[model samples]
Target: MTTTDAVRPTGPGLGAVLSDAELAAVRADFPLLGRTVRGGRPLVYLDSAATSQKPSVVLEAEVDFYEQRNAAVHRGAHQLAEEATEAFEAAREAVAAFVGAGAGEIVWTPGATAAINLVAYAFSNATAGRGGAAAEPFRLVPGDEIVVTAAEHHANLVPWQELCARTGAVLRWFGVTDDGRLDLSNLDEVITERTRVVAFAHVSNVTGAVAPVAELLAAARRVGAYTVLDACQSVPNLPVDLPALGVDFAAFSGHKLLGPTGVGALYGRRELLEAMPPVTTGGSMVEVVTMEATTYAPPPQRFEAGTQMVAQAVGMGVAAQWLGELGMEAVAAHERELAAELVKIAEIPGVRVIGPVDTADRLAVVSFVVDGVHAHDVGQVLDDRGIAVRVGHHCAQPLHRRFGVAATARASASVYTTADEIIAFREALAGVRAFFGVD
Candidate 1:
């Protein structure tokens, strides 16, 4: 067959160069890909949206950390300590460059959830009218409103809800449209002068809809509201440059982006991070302490309390470098092809996709429901076939409620996903109706 014919025959009718050899090469880089599941079925991991499989490069980096450079950082007296500190700080610079921010602006946290809570808790302090010399800009008061969206994951929503309850500030949010896109029509009305903080997801975890970030930031700027973006989904799947986006704060996870768990980074504009009080106070975060009074370190260190996840940070840094080497443009192109395939699967009979079919404006997260088949059952059938997918609310209960469904089966793709895997997923999903004896 000719090259054009080979490419054109692929599913979703897209013209892209996806070779089995290329996919095989990529698969070899993941140690888990060589393993089997359910006794002897080759794993077809389609749940990158939940957490990605780590590459060998990232794994080896973690191993190297413990084997060669295992020591405490920031307070070192000897050679190994110095090496550990250097590696840890280099990891910070790598993370900073990963999302287009300064090294000093990146604060290490346990995960995206912790990072988001840091921002929310700091705002809670502000709402209580607590301010010293450094805490002036974060102050929020009664009648102040915080704006979010109905599509936010619980990590993004619950913190703001708790903040509102603690501070007497009203919590407002933009609802979803019938098509599963965020209804920004009420942008002006929702983000008024009373709105002190505006927190939203960069990409909906359920709908995969990309928010109008520029427009949203413009609205928030007019009202002088602090903007906090939950980039847990976007940073892993898209080319994110937080500095250029002009958000005051952002957070994302390392595990979702091909790194280890227990390590994530929060990016705050230096001035903003400096102005907000640390949510968790402990040994490393303090500058000096007396029986009566205590002083805290500036910005990043202030927010980072207790012992750091040194090895995980180094591994994440390697993952960031790996993604950087492959180039975000290449990763985006690969997932775009995968998204097109997912859209086609959604078009199958008795299948109802939960979000917009437009692949251009969204990431590769595809949530859908099979007629008369429970999401858990659908997930089980796929699992029996060695395909992994996320079933249930995917941690966005409000979004599921908006779609008028109790649950959904989500298949998310990443740079490693191939067209053949998508095809296998579709075929497996097709078997669900017949097996369940549903129309």
Candidate 2:
């Protein structure tokens, strides 16, 4: 177990998905990649699942907004406000287009967690008779069931748990298989007629296993239940079409998609959003407000309370445009090559890959545990060599519990990841057991 005689990976390996020159150019767009870390060691970042490094274009977009047009949107008749409102709305349209959603279907939230909470709280409110007859579809009775998967991130899981708690509904979850995929064998039993909602992650942050969206959606449809998708992991790395996926609601964050951290989007069907009550109440979301009564605006505005994250939204819009120009299919292909190399960690002795060993229908996110070593120690060893990775339960405690692990060291890739970086990671990983005297 050593770095000696290790051969570096080369090319995109996915035939012109990203030419060597184009790949190099794409890497150059990320300014942080140019810096060295840990006493002059070259940085090898592989934690895109936590937060992607911002590209120059995205950074420039945010700076440009603050420098040129910084004003509150939708509340003023002045010139700066008008420009800000237009820019903000334009960013909304761009982000909506990126996911194949209508502009009106998008609601601005602080991040993916908030987006999920918005829907959850709306449901809680509906059960309390908040939206009147319009929200009857969202109401949950004591015996009604809410379905989730064991592989869901905490963002997608906890909110629904809280919702069920508030509404006296039962919370049930689909099991994860030994191979880390959702165990959909009991789909009919799990998503019965008593189920009112089914929520799951589009791609697991820990295992990188792509959920069976079509199968899950079909079951939900058969039972006449609404579907909520946690797209935080998939939207950044894969070609996602929310409209085509036909989920009733979806959520993703900007920071995971090469944009800023303060903004994210929730995509709901227009009619559902219109019917759902706003979770947060404030100035901008209202149509008319009195001392005793208030009427809210439409879907997008109603969910977007108070001032929005204008610059962050603009940066995310630029990020969406940048990814669109590169083409999501090529992005997925490039990452597939990276994942193929990444999964080779399982070939090393005493190291177990936590997900499906194959790259099919998966993104580049990979997690593994080393024998006789804590995940934090493994992460520290890699970090000492300037290899950045995530190490922990990764917000999916149930999935880790299912695998009989407390935590794992994860290496995730983005569009900027190169074959050399993957090689570095592999070589660094090869030395872990030996370094700890476990071999």
Please, what is the TM-score per model? 0.94, 0.96
Q: Evaluated with TM-score, which candidate comes out highest?
A: 2
User: Whole-model lDDT, candidate 1?
Assistant: 0.86
- Cα lDDT tens digits, model 1, 105-157, are 99999999999999989877765655476676677677889999999999999
Question: Residue 243 of model 2: what lDDT?
Answer: 90
> CA lDDT of each candidate?
0.86, 0.90
Model 1 lowest lDDT segment of ten? 1-10
**Candidate topping lDDT:** 2
Model 1 lDDT, residue 437, Cα: 94
Model 2 per-residue lDDT tens digits across residues 195-277 = 99999999999999999999999999999999999999999988899999999999999999998999999999999999998
Q: What are the per-model numbers of colliding residue pairs? A: 1, 0
